[model samples]
Target: MNLISCAALAAALCISVHAAAAAPVKIVAAENFYADVARQIGGAHVQVTSILNNPDQDPHLFEASPSVGRALTHAKIVVYNGADYDPWMDKLLSASKASDRRTIVTGQLAHKQSGDNPHLWYDPSVMPLVAKELATTLEASDPPNAQDYAKNLQSFLAALKPIDARIKAIKAKYASTPVTATEPVFGYMAKALGLDMRNEHFQLSVMNDTEPSASDTAAFESDLRNHAVKLFIYNSQASDGAATRMLALAKQSGVPVLGVTETAPAGKSFQRWMLNELAAVEKALAH
Candidate 1:
């Protein structure tokens, strides 16, 4: 009874240990774009969940649900756009205190703070930083797969070269070209491209869902009406009457309008999404 029973028990324990070690790391990102980055770097080694994935929904309006909290409870790694962009993530993390969990705040990595422009993913420098940090986190968490994580991270960084080149070319050709946006969703990218962005007060008001002062509204309209801004960008995901009116006015005045979303669309990787947006900007500026 003793010899056969001991051998079978040891074999079962060995199999259990291997299965546990082979389980994929779980990651939860507050936004889908970050999840996409996690997927790129993690590949098959991680399972990622993105809270704000719907392109049609406004991320600013996101409220965390119970399921999100449950996901956070099981997540080994968490990523979120900080600087108050997705404050709900902070609340959820605090509620579920796990000492082993690692949280990567993209805004903090970008040296952004509260009251600063929170649309940080649009910053060309931010995502590369995020990718590196994500790879490092994965390596530290799963040393057995460190080499694969490093390779994926390298590929992810290399993919950004075209995006960087696009930004450089645009900046060289269109530096200081006047542009205006209904919201600051693309503010960082616009800054990278060296475009002159106008109507800050109005954009902040719209982003915060506050009423823009009458004078600020008038100035925004005047810019569009007079073709003062070379390009007019509106937050396509979230809009109000003021934004809608400005969009129509831009069309009336023959100003080129570009729509940028706070969240990336589905079926596109982070790299592809950025490239597409950059291409659109280049197209609009050419016309």
Candidate 2:
């Protein structure tokens, strides 16, 4: 082989290495929760992006913009809650026709079909599964950094162990404790903590953003007046007039209120925000 041929081969190899190192794996997360998990598992190898980050807006009613479509079109992997919660992503994915892109749907992970609750992230068991799946998918997409991806997944799972332990402790401490909420957003977490929830009708109605019937409202008011629930979990994102009224009634009855956010609020890390919310619930129960 000539010297020039050897130099050309070396340059090509260097170019290939540089390309692999410079190219970031693009990930599109339909919700903020998935975005957080993706970041934890992907670390510096993946660029995780989320469409829904507004704590004040209802995720169910989210409308996709041109930028979202473009993101979906270019994403190497996508994560979404599939129980008709982020149906906009479904439409965008279908329209974009990116068959090669890997997609993970949390509802499918839970074996739930349409109309089922889409808030799967609140379940303590879901995050590890999602992280593992994400790591696997990222490994498949970018084989050059498979070891890094695995290491990140292991670190994230290790960190999550204590969070799960904390949840179990709360459950043991508050077994069968009575709680109430304006919406079913926190039902999974509450159930995991073994908190018995009252005012289901009001929760479901508010969750669907439909007006509660007169009888349902009256029943919820009676429950509040009678102090039927020890703690009131208020959804800060979509608090309707009914929820506001319920909050007032809970205050009058001396029931402690724990405010919950549907999305990670401004200036808070995902795990910190969740821990803070759970701590608030614990405080309310303690009081």
Candidate 3:
């Protein structure tokens, strides 16, 4: 019990406390766009990992690995797109259970069911709900940073104003505009814009990796050849033989085509990605 020994012990204790306070909250999101939103809200207070980040890969064919399970073990918050879009996430989460882990399901937030179009993020209203929920969750988990979370939530919502405006402008100008897609990935956004989406059976068949009936296929082709729809949207990330052929036919018929992807591209924020797609839609419709 010397004076020097006591002083050294007190300094070590203080250093340990400061280090613990500075540690960032760990979050894992099934999709990168969700992760991007979490980052926008959490800022420097959180560390995020997104499993489906590759824009070139088809997300429908995604399979989880052991490392993803390991990542979940240390996470305090987990975000996922449910409603059968990422069914593999269910299995991975169930395998690694944590008492303190909080999960946010976009499908549940939007009241979407298993058979509904699982790309819930395409809906403009869905992200605001997600951002609010994320802010509330972050505040609850780390009270010290509550004010920052609330401020970030406001910024995130404000950032979405342009997107809402664009949708309103498009809907006002072109409500019920005839459009067809190779898959249902952009169905929700298209609905928001008041589009008359055609060929549901064919889109669903291609999405589920099944062959569309001869009649359904013929109808889709006829629509393209006769220029029934004003615009053709193709899921560039997950195209099959049927979708590819339809895309070619649409071009041959001189119909305007737009390419959309299921996931946000690398280095683009969720807000920028949506706005860019909207701009492209506006340009194509004017053609």
Best by lDDT: 3
Output the TM-score of candidate 2. 0.93
Query: Which pairs clash in model 1?
Result: none
Give candidate 1 misplaced runs (Cα > 4 Å): none
Q: Give the TM-score of candidate 3.
A: 0.97
> Which of 1 and 2 is ahead in lDDT?
1
State the lDDT at 23 in candidate 3.
Answer: 84
RMSD of each: 1.3, 2.0, 1.2
lDDT of 1 by residue, 108-158 (tens): 898887899999999888898999999999999999999999999999999
lDDT score of residue 39 within candidate 3? 99
Candidate rank order under lDDT = 3, 1, 2
lDDT (0-100) at residue 53 of candidate 2?
A: 94
- Candidate 3, 139-235: lDDT as tens digits: 9998889999999999999999999999999999999999999989899999999999999999999988899999999999999999999999999
The global C-alpha lDDT for each of the candidates, from Candidate 1 onward, is: 0.93, 0.84, 0.94
Candidate 1, residue 142: lDDT: 96
Off by over 4 Å in 3: 2-4
